[model samples]
Target: MRCEEIRELLVAHADGELDDVERERVDSHLANCPACRRERAAFESTGNLLSLLGPVPGAGRSISARVMATVRGEDPWCGHIRRELTAFVDGELTEAEARPVREHLATCAACAAESRALERTGDALRAWKLPSMRIGLARLFAPPRARGRLLRFAAALAAACLLLAVGIAFFVSESGTATPPPGLLRAMEMLDPATLEILDQDPGLLEIVRDLELLESVTDEEVALLTLNGSGG
Candidate 1:
């Protein structure tokens, strides 16, 4: 993980909000970059300071008030921190939530340049950041593919949950409802009177289980004998 990216994630990581893989990346980065580590510590300290504020004041400021005040009729700031894009840049937009910003940035030159400036600032900070950690041999040889792995893992978990839910619903609906395979039912129907008698006369025939591969090589007589023996039982 790059130092700048780690700075973005450090707050969430320290707060125990990051997934295991993300946590690992932060830990790995922290081991190498002391500056980023300090930034992370500073972020944690900020979080603690914010927590002391106790449930950050809500979106108390009316959007219409400032919009009307400036005659712009647009809320340049909606929630906290007093500026729209600044609040967004402070790690508010998630993977899904960032899509709108991305679309806007693509079309709006002013916003895009502002975003670039923010990124440059973050990059400069990372250049000076040092790792407060030592990387062990085991941690150096690691792969970096969190987004896909998380997606696949989530998909598998969802599939397993769906299967479990289906199983529960099926068993709930079908308790005491037992049915044989169609092939077995047909074979049972095929047991005519004479065949049943022949089978009944011989109980020791064990070739009723047709899956016995060796029985494929058995003589016709033996097959007949086994079939009859099975029916008799």
Candidate 2:
């Protein structure tokens, strides 16, 4: 059998719910496939965990009632009934409610996947640990008026940092000369004619600007070639 077909049977096989023929097929496949064996082992281990929780109180009647309701042609997919799946996983459902959920999960692949995902999430949350924290320690406890001023100062600093970061990013995209500081590039963009003339006195600065203009005029195809060839132009 294909891996997927074998997988669909793994859970049922682990639960001993498969018919003899299907069980033999799964057993043959598992004997040869280490991955499927691992999967079966994992499911069996999770089943053991579930067994430890024992039976949920008051779940039998609820499961029977839900099954009866479903038999009466009530929509099992309705929101209220569907929401019970979560409660069912949490052991909040009585046996009656839990039974239908378990049967539904066994038959419906999507609901079964969701129930496993919920179970994994619950396991993770249960295993998670929070580090101990000291209360009100390492705090300045600034007065409200002072805190307001601090917030305004932080806002202004953040704005300034944002602008500086943007300027640097634009400079990189523009391929500003490494010889000149990024601030110099920004200054040159907004400089008066006299300031630009002074900058032009530097041969290296003038050469970079000339190359930038040539790049701006290059055709798309030429740019593609340049990119492919790693050409300076």
Tens digit per residue, CA lDDT, model 2, 119-143:
6544433332212101111121234
User: What is the total number of backbone clashes in candidate 1?
Assistant: 11
Clashes within 3 Å, all models in order? 11, 12
Cand. 2 Cα-lDDT: 0.53
Tell me the RMSD of model 2 versus the true structure: 28.0
Winner by TM-score: 2
Q: Can you tell me which runs of candidate 2 are displaced by over 4 Å? A: 1-81, 132-233
- How does each model score on TM-score? 0.23, 0.26
